[model samples]
Target: MREEYELEVLERYDVEVRSTRRIRGAFFCDTDRGTMLLKETALSGRRALLLYRALSRLEQKGNVKVDTPVFTEDGELLVSSAEGSVYMLKKWYQGRECDIRQEGELARAAKELALLHLELADSAEWSGGAKTGIGANDSTVPGGVLPVGRNPLDEIRRHNRELKKVRSFVRGRVAKNEFEYLFLDSFGKMFRIAEAVAARMENSGCMKLFSESCRRRDLVHGDYNYHNILMTKEGPAITNFEHMHVDIQAGDLYYLTRKAMEKNHWKQKTGQLIVDSYEKARRLSDAEREYLALCLAYPEKYWKTASSYYHSNKAWLPEKCVEKLKLAVRQTDEKYDFLAKTFGLIL
Candidate 1:
């Protein structure tokens, strides 16, 4: 019923829908205005406006194509149905998801990401060292606003504690499963690596870097994996800025690099290609480089798998968990080698 109601919601817009197709959890509508997508959203009013504003700003930049939100006839970014369901429409593009495995595509995506950072920086520019478009309470502002920046160092420390907690939980289990045994086997080494990386990050002046970046109001595409990027004929059309927020811009690069490397089995050339392509547009400062290397050094995959296992059903463990554990463990050597050769770090 809600799905059918979505079409009615589109009537709020002036365009006449000629056809509608469902794909990737979104409705692709061929409208009189152009291609548009309608999808249900749980975004709060503030968050929805934030995304709309960010994408609108990006749309102004000629080269950066984004799926900016389309306002309703009543000048609302979101429209509600009879049952209180909310939906947002956007100007969609004709394209497919970027293929991360292809080297050329990967390189193009990296460069495109760097270009995006430049635009996000421009949109988030600060004046006289004072922030803009940010309010005391985000809900108070309707024009949309960027949130306060977060320090990655704090997150790293918290993750470290969670890693220990998961380890203790697994150790307390007398009748351990295969995943538990493997986690125990790798816990000591992975923990040491985590600690070393955390210590290095603390001393790397990253806090100062983060503070300055926040003052500058730098923004990152919070979720920058391949799925968000569309491979259009014009080029990579970056979409979905919902998770976009103020943070160290390099964090986005780190995420893209890590995800691509993981898929390529921690290939050194792949890592180098990504960094090189990104550096072509925006170069990483010394501190940013160190920050990125340390971030990649931590056993994030290992921690995530164990954390998932700890919180899931223990009696009937999924086989995929064991496979993921083995893969994470097996990739340690390759990951370390890529880190050392590509970033010149020996941890």
Candidate 2:
């Protein structure tokens, strides 16, 4: 960013900037008070304030690791920038991301996530009259209503169709590269697996699972992974609430555990360790366990790899894409074994 532009955005925050450095699309501002993060966004005023309030409410409820948007002198969370762009200032924190390889960190992160989930769940509770939590008493917030509209199986069926479409698209290419060659070789197996998974999903009768979670107002941190968590002296501090939304909470648990499981070669012991640690915080019910099992049974990563290749602009596919397919195939194999052993069902 230009120095002149930097100074302009800094004026919105009530801090005296001593220095600035660019990091990961955000500027790190060293000010008299402390380090801060500044980034330009094209968010509308209404939407920005909604997210700002949600994040601040979470922090105020004792989830300090969640960085709340700083309010300007005029009481606005968003500051206007040059060219009409808006920006928000957040306090910068220093800590390393938790390493899942170590059992100590892994178990701690699990409990922290569970505690965080509990906080998020309780944040939606309404105790009559206006309360201290986020949209707690607001009945019109859509989160309170049961999410019974969509069938979860519909999504799997859609993805299954796309997989076949992409496979056919690749098969029709007159002259293809080595990546296409590798893709075609594994395409049949992956496609068959997707079809089977879709059939399994249809027969699982999991729509009630989705509705129950939403009716309880269990919010998910849309994107929960090791990268979004910081291993600080205070314990695990989760950051980046930009993707926070209301959803089935089990989805969040599954992603974090899947990330750890994938890293550990889909070993049952590692999966057991995570589930055991998390259950100590908030035990998973039998229905939730079944929902989580079905979620893990699907081959989402393989579908995404193929979908990404097809959607992105391309003259020739990259070699790394093919390499990822090879790794994905191997990972899917381990996942099947892990799921079969844990659930006593075919994956």
Best by lDDT: 1
lDDT of 2 by residue, 217-314 (tens): 56667678888878888777777666665566777888888888878989888887888888889887777777778778777777878889989766
Candidate 2 stretches with Cα past 4 Å from truth are 1-3, 126-151
Taking the tens digit of each residue's C-alpha lDDT, what string does model 1 give over 50-140?
7877777678767688899999989888888988888899998899988889989999999999999888775443211246544323322
Q: Candidate 1: list runs displaced more than 4 Å.
A: 124-142
| Model 2: worst 10 consecutive residues (lDDT sum) | 127-136
lDDT of each: 0.83, 0.72
Model 2 has an lDDT value of 0.72
Best by TM-score: 1
**Per-model C-alpha RMSD:** 2.6, 4.0
- What is the alpha-carbon lDDT for the whole of candidate 1? 0.83
